[model samples]
Target: MSTVVETILSNHPQAKRDSLIPILQEVQEMEGFISREAIASIGKHLNLPTSKIYGVATFYNQFRFQNVGKYHVMVCRGTACHVKGSAKVLEAVKRELKIEPGTTSRDGLFSLEIVACMGACGLAPVISINGEFHAGVEPDKIKGILNAYRRKESENVK
Candidate 1:
């Protein structure tokens, strides 16, 4: 078993015996997403069926089965934001990140997602990073915003 998987399992041994969903949620939060191996490991540790664990993971949008990047960037594509040029903003972000929506960068520094709405119509063309909203965004601002995240990551690496 991978160290992360072992650590997760060991950290929640009691969780292994019951209620794997919440345990998986906590694991995903720490690891960014769950892997197939993780599901199997969790199943074995908990004595639950893999199918049931997979079902629970699929039932929740909050759970991610694929790997995610260091930063999660979400662009609002709601009607209000659409009218305000969210598409263009999204395009700029894609160009800057060099990855389409629902993809992570090769370096795993960023991932992009498009959401229907964030309920911030007044701040149309909004973008969120790890749930922190940036409102009234312009296409030109995407690079700087991503750069800020990069900068922060670099600082943390030192």
Candidate 2:
């Protein structure tokens, strides 16, 4: 992991503090999620503190510290979806996954994200797992949806 970060840092030998986002973006792009070591390497390369680098990363929703799970669950909280019971749906996900938004499940099979919108208003109360939209989501159905992904993983493991 640090090796990848080191290679990325080598590209920005002349990087300034202003280059933080680009560097972080590159890290996230290549590594899927930034690790503490990546932030440390970036800080050393940019002459910034780890706190500053982490703060910057946290400031942007696009950044993630934990490695994303195989199924990245995005729950829509847009106005339309919200009115259609997205909040309950979101809670249901948290309950089922045993992890909240911006977090990956203990099994590393799922990560939850609450997004403002996904442009699927016609299908309000929607959620997208790995970019596959599941519209008209109901709280009771959250477990089945999650279990389906788990089953897929288990099958592949076999």
Candidate 3:
């Protein structure tokens, strides 16, 4: 078992069925997502079926099945933002990153998520990268934003 999987599983005993959600949350916190190996390990540890674990995890929107990339992008598609052309902005991001929502870019530098609302109605079209919000986003501005992140990544390696 992976260290994270083993470590978390160690904390929750087999008899504590109510601890499943907490265990899953901790695994996701440490590993970035709930991996398949983690599901299997958790199942074996809890004496529960893997399908049951998956069912519980799937019932909640908080669990992520795939690992998030270094820069997680969340695009607001709420009613207000949608009216202000967030769709175009979303398309722009998809083009710039060459990735769909709920997916990571090929190089693992970026991941995309579409959120229903950010409560930033004033900023009709907004995109957030790693919690940094970019307000009043326009399709034309997407390339520059992505390039800036790419530049930052390259600089980090240097």
Q: Give all candidates' CA lDDT scores.
A: 0.86, 0.91, 0.90
User: What's each prediction's clash count?
Assistant: 0, 0, 0
lDDT of 3 by residue, 1-158 (tens): 79988988877755466789999999999998889999999888888899999999988867878788899999999999999999999999998889877778878899998899999999889999999999999999999998999999999999
Worst 10 residues of 3 by lDDT: 10-19
Best-to-worst TM-score order: 2, 3, 1
TM-score of each: 0.63, 0.91, 0.80
Model 2 over residues 1-158: C-alpha lDDT tens digits?
A: 47888888898889999999999999999999988889878888899999989888888888888888989999999999999999999999999999978889877889988899999999999999999999899999999998999898999999
Query: Candidate 2 regions off by >4 Å?
Result: none
lDDT of 3: 0.90
RMSD (Cα, Å) of candidate 2?
A: 1.5
Question: What TM-score would candidate 2 get against the native?
Answer: 0.91
For residue 46, give model 3's deviation from the true position in Å: 3.0
Residue-level lDDT tens digits of model 1 in 85-138: 999999999999999776789998988888999999999989999989999999
Q: Identify the candidate with maximal lDDT.
A: 2
